[model samples]
Target chain A: MPVDHKRINGPENTIPYKLYTKLNVKSFKEALQDAVKNGVRNDKRKLDEHRRIFMKTDIVSQAKGSAYIEIGNTKVVVSVFDPREIPNKNEYSLNGELYCEFKFAPFSCPKRRLHQQDAEEKQNSIVMKQALEPAVCRHEFPNFQVDVYALVLENDGSALSAAITCAGLALAQAGIPMFDIITSVTIGIQGDLKLLDPMLHEETLCYTSINKNSKTGKNSHGIVILSLLNTHQQVTEFYQVGSLDIDDIEECTKVLTEANKVVVPLVEKCLAKHVIKGVKESSQ
Target chain B: MTLSEAEKTFILHGVQENFRIDGRNRDDYRPMELETSIITHAFGSARLRLANTDVVVTVKVEIDVPFPDRPLEGKMEFFIDCSANATPDFEGRGGENLATEISNTLTAAYSSNSVFDYTKLCILKGRKCWKIYVDILILECGGNLYDAISIAVKAALWNTSIPLVKSVTIDGNNVDMNVSENLSDCIKLDISAAPLMVTLCKIGDHCVVDPTSAEEQCSQGAIVVAISKGKFSTVFQTGGGSLHPLTLMEKLKLGAKVGNRLEEALSEALSKIKENGEMGFLN
Candidate 1:
């Protein structure tokens, strides 16, 4: 009965586990070349095309405002609580606080997540907060803190972008004042192929490996996530993983900004629907 | 969530009269929506929504060495996470205490051999075994958390399919296991004896099952009874109020009866559930 040892509280084992058996695996360079030559991806989407997105707001009844976003297999739910007095606040401050906690459900990913938020999740939480900080009208609720909790129900890829986008919609649905709508998109780059909203497999295949043999040209295959304030045309936050050349980074940012433009209308439509439903209910 | 004295009196009188605030009888449960195999990555998963209280349970299995003391038994672990989205109070580590209490209660309820046969999970008896991780996420809190969690866990376990082991090679201190390659080659657990927990809250001398958050606040005391195959697997008193011996017996009886009915209904729903259908929070 190895049950007792399993019951003990300890840090989760961080060892990675492979979900699919590696068979007929194509090298990173070959995969990149195939995408560039054939103009098609494994999922059959064009290199610059994104997965279909499904967005809805006011899904969680308990939270003041909530939204559920599903982009292909990636599903994330974000809830925004009502603003409250900042805990541990002794002196008055003009800036309102934004608290974000991003978590992946224990069974959301290929690997089981621990009950506690891990380092990656904590970093994402901070990134999310920073992404939405400039968009929100903090001066309206000075000395108060608005809590945003994003839970990834399923993670295929581009989860952080989905969270940021979903959180912005949730805040708007919660009736929090904001300067403009915020939207985000993630771009995966491998060689000359640029994938918009790449699925988990494509993302891992493109970004996880770095070509060690390259000594002259750019060997950077990486991911770039950009949060944009659509109306104001401002880049609120930009997060990049892996090494990339200046040209590649510029191209990725341009593609990601374009993708964000496509997502903003969807977010606006969801918020409008929420507001319409609220008005109808009140009238009835 | 404070209730006025008037509200408490109304609830107390309603319970005594066998009619709850929401028009449900003493033993009546709230309408529940259950969906299974929701998480694609998990071996088994289920989401149960009893009114506003939502719980999702996922089962993950791994191979591990058997304990020296219980050489013939496998392992089953329960982890409960209280999502901050459920309530603002659960922010940071604020919900740790409640999460621990619920997980501990589930462990006790499933500890009985009759409730869940752990030996069935054993692979190489004494040497190696399959470790099952039952992770529960509380998405909302309406009330009767114990009952909702138990139902979700049972459904998740029922939906669980352990990968079929093809072969095992023992090489001195090392052992290797080969699992079947076919995706459908798996074993589904027999959950006929899985326990179902029922919470009976005593309000003004009368016990009521499936107490909502408001009724829970009005309850003087409550008993959580875990019933498996018409037998009590575990019983624990909750809340701060005390109960007399006679009252306790009465509440236990009510809990057992409700628990059995719940178990039957759950099995019936599970059997009716189609393998592939529209599921998850979308619907």
Candidate 2:
């Protein structure tokens, strides 16, 4: 691996001290079982309830459009830059291309992240681009490229969905033509319990396959993230990990779609506030 | 590759008529040839050729400590390298995006423990474990890269023979193990539940599997579904276009059906493979 001199690099193989702590020494299966008690999450949220979201537009003055969003402990900021000519391509493109970058702050997670984008971040970038592309009117700005950057300040959970939601807001704030507002949500399934908008710890537990105690060989556990265009009722991007039956997936999608609907009005209200403020300023 | 508008329209019309540019129908796949144990140096390797698309997958294993969170499970990683020989666009870091996408998909597809048992690879609980590295090199790109790569990976894994461990002794923080030196004393991976990816390209209101480059250019959207043991291990939407919920569900069902048939065909072909000498790119 190439050394990054720009930022202070930690020791080559420094594990998080939390791993050695007594509280976390227990097996993940035990921890997973303890995550939810009496239909309430560790953080005291309902099984299908989402964390309160705080959103603001035009936070970054330098960018053409920018939005900052916070869902519980997860904080993400997205910025959209003005359309520019394609960098290396010489051929004329019939549709505008989107360049998306998803990054995590070095101190975002429990463990220190590298300055460079890792495999997970790169994959998230592609997912973000796919989720936002269908909503953007690429034909409106043919032969141009729009750059979108998402930075996770603190990743508690559902950072990718938060970034997707923020990116849509940023694009709308930038006055980019769009079909509809794009909202995204993540659902984590563990056995028969489904946790909507899973926190970081809950997400990790769902990702680990530790249903050895179950009598049946099949165990349902996974994380599903879906991005929806509200007006069109289309799924722009869907990504899933872990083992899930088709029936489980069908139920999860239905739950996720409803979860996305809950977020649509919140996002629209934020954008509406921005629009109303802009109109008031121009009128004054 | 860039296609002319006229060509795109022609392909679109063909898809609408249920006849592809090639003689194959919408669901039919091109002829594919698979060869395993091609790389002698690697523990296991396979090369697959699906018409103009070519992929070489090699599996190498190394002993390492398991993750603290999931100590009972070993690790499996997928790495993709797009050779410049396949296309000029893949030179330098140009292929990084495509490489990352394919590797990520493979990673997710194989993440399920039931699909490829990770506990079998663990030598000791919370201690030593085998980390399998699946490196895929794309020698050519026709289209339907996901399906070809996944099939080649499964074949390579099937050919892999993990060295058997005789015993292990741990003292405080130090650990030692005895591995069998006999070449024949090895364990084979149970890959029956290994997932196979099928890409369903939506073109002109119809879905097609194993599309060629020409047909790929005409697709409005594409869904890559990874099926393992008749269950969905992963489902991803690629490309720029979006699809309605109904269309997405329809394509997922179609992909699963095609994936199961392809899985059967591949396993049968794998069983028929003989230890033929002097095989590879040379042959």
Best of the candidates, lDDT: 2
Candidate 1 residue runs with Cα over 4 Å from true position: A1-284, B278-283
Tens-digit lDDT track for model 1 on B1-283? 6789999999888888888889999889999999899999999999999999999999999988776545678888888899998877688877875776577667766764545677888888678899999999999989999999999999999999999999989999787889999988999998897888888887887888888999998986676777777655555555534443335556666766787788889989998998767765688
How well is each residue in A158-217 modelled by candidate 1, as lDDT tens digits?
Answer: 999999999999999998999899898988866566789988867775543345356764
Which candidate number has the best TM-score?
2
lDDT of 2 by residue, A172-247 (tens): 9998899999999999988888999999999988875677457874478889999999888999999988888778
Scored by lDDT, model 1 comes in at 0.80
DockQ of 1: 0.01
